[model samples]
Target: MNAESSVGAQPTASAPKRFALPSPARRALLRAGLTGAAAVGVSTALGAASASATPTTTSRNRPGTPDEALRELAVGNRRWRTFRQRHPHESPAVRQSLTSGQEPFAVVLGCIDSRVPPELVFDQGLGDLMTVRSAGEVLDEAVLGSVAYGVLELDIPLVMVLGHQSCGAVKAAVAADESGESLPAHIQYIADRIAPNIDRTKEGDARVDATIDANVRAVRAALAAEPDLAAKIATGELAVVGARYELSDQRVHRLA
Candidate 1:
């Protein structure tokens, strides 16, 4: 799915009309200029990768099984890494067909990082994935409710907690505990929740990637431990998987 499409299109300032230029030529040139301007704007606003030739990622219908969900994502990543993305499948028919119902395949709990979009990383099309995001992929009441909706209402069988390298949220939590600095009231709650997992983490760790991985595992265990979801696991109606993303390689390694 094109998450960006959630914003839909907005009319920008109209380009100065080309008085002497012919209508067709002027329109083509104007569109080209806007595309270039957009490229620059996105790169500056988001990051360098936004300017690259890599086709932006999107998802279609949700996959059926957990393994199938995983495979679909893997294929998407392959296309992304190799710059061979398939054209999007959205059309009037697909939109109209989904208007009455939506059956997403997988539910993902992930960080609110723009770079690690679940649909893009997994290369899923529209309606293919149900995603919940927060800083550090932290679990809170609201986040839990979102996950529950995906599982109970959407009937998504696989829920993946996707963490990633160089996570700013996890780093802040680690630093807060190490320095004994009191975090903000709400942030303090998050730090407290994640602090134990940090303690269980190895000593003398230099890389934040390790903490990111550990946090994914910790969140998965915590989710499973919740009485609300534990019952579903017992009946084999749901599976919770953990994964970490590699920033350099653009890959997701499953932890659970």
Candidate 2:
């Protein structure tokens, strides 16, 4: 009453109307904002982690030693054998990463048999392996040069001579040797290279199988003996191994 009397004679209107949220409502709004912000932060962190987890195909990140390279191949083959292949390094990003250069870990000299394609059998994608193929894993000047380049120039650590079971080239070579039959000019060249690997004492499929295994070992020995490669082997910087792929079981068995 005293305050009212002090005001001007004309009755003062009530203070301007005001509105405010309830305390609980205000807290709810604040919590919602904080939750949204936290979600954004979590998303960013997860994105970074995902990026880090993906493999990169750069030289710095490539396998550093022959054992490391061989381990990768073995794991990949295990996946392939188990039907769980990850099929790594085939994405667009992987392809782009290789534009600058390549650091293949291994050189695979395999048969030209379609079923034994090195990339598929090993479950490796592009830029992971330097592959050379010839009938019955035969090595010619060009093939040897290619492998040499991978070793001497590119510094590939592992050289794998991959043979396969039930190889046609081996069978043909066995036939040519047994029948004294002369194959066509180019075919004869392949047969000639493969014939020496066959064991004449073994007959039929036994002879063919023996030839395939012998061919792989012979090629590995030859590569290991190469002057440039020999130094690397002696220094423990390179390894030459023979492996055989079984078509029926889809497995790779190391022969040496």
Candidate 3:
């Protein structure tokens, strides 16, 4: 879905009521590193909504702010981990309605790992989350531009970089770096982007794991620092966060 498209009916239905998280819990999440503040200066510029309230329905239930977007994702991930997914917005009516226009709540930049599909991992459906995937969560002009389009054009409130435990891209990068071997074709491009941020000192799975999180953080920082997105973040209109998904436990951990 192109947020830049100028032709369509933009729905103005107020975002639906969602699962509200209390203040103390929100503070605990902050401390626990489930979110970062604007997530760096994120705490200051925000408007009054501090709670993590999540949506429970179709596109009509838009999450209008960063906290709301984060809340819905948290709820979706929880449903995924607990095996209680609502599978919201897969209905034909929801699909048909989206044909006229789209108002997604968040933009998710995650790894291309088959196991870490953004929609399934977050338990979101069509028109709910705008997704962009690259191996190891690497960034490039096109990737950055896609994210910008969501925040600047669609006014989407959140951007999340999801890195999972035991990511193969990071694993491959570590292997290549350690062996002094070069990756072939476009794979080398991916490795080169990740090479600087990779923690080569750690061995075995530790190195790959560290790189996985590091790559996510790097991507998160890059998106947060993008000039266009930074302005919206200043007004509390958007937020960029880093998270790690543990495949073993089926839980998604938000990073600090």
Q: Clashes in each model (backbone N, CA, C under 3 Å)? A: 10, 0, 6
Q: By the lDDT metric, which is better: model 2 or model 3?
A: 2
Q: Could you arrange the candidates by lDDT from highest to lowest?
A: 2, 3, 1
* Alpha carbon lDDT of each predicted model: 0.66, 0.73, 0.72
In candidate 3, the residue pairs with backbone N, CA or C atoms under 3 Å apart (3 or more residues apart, or in different chains) clash, namely: 36-39, 37-40, 37-42, 38-41, 38-42, 38-43
Predicted candidate 1 versus true structure: per-residue lDDT over 1-256, tens digit per residue: 1122111111131211111222446545554564567668867887632222121233344465655666666677777666677634466765545533466778889999889998787766666678999988988767876686566555677788889888878888888878899887787877776666674445545535567776777777666665545566666667677777777888776763
Best by lDDT: 2
Model 1 lowest lDDT segment of ten: 1-10
- For model 3, residues 1-256, the per-residue Cα lDDT tens digits are 1122111111122211122222545534543452233234434664322211223233476889888888788889889989998898889887666644567898999888899888987899978888999998888867876676566556788888888988888888888988999988899889888877787678788888888877777777766765566667777777877788999988877766
Runs in model 2 deviating more than 4 A are 1-60
Clashing pairs in 2: none
| lDDT value, residue 121 of candidate 3 | 75
Give the higher-lDDT candidate: 1 or 2.
2
Put down candidate 2 lDDT per residue, 1-256, tens digits, no spaces: 0111211111122211122222445545554554456556757876321111123446446776767877778788888989998788888877667644567888999988999998988899888889999998888777886787677656788888899999998888889999999987799998998776778778888888888888777777676666667678777788777789999988887774
Q: Over 4 Å off in model 1, which ranges?
A: 1-62, 199-207
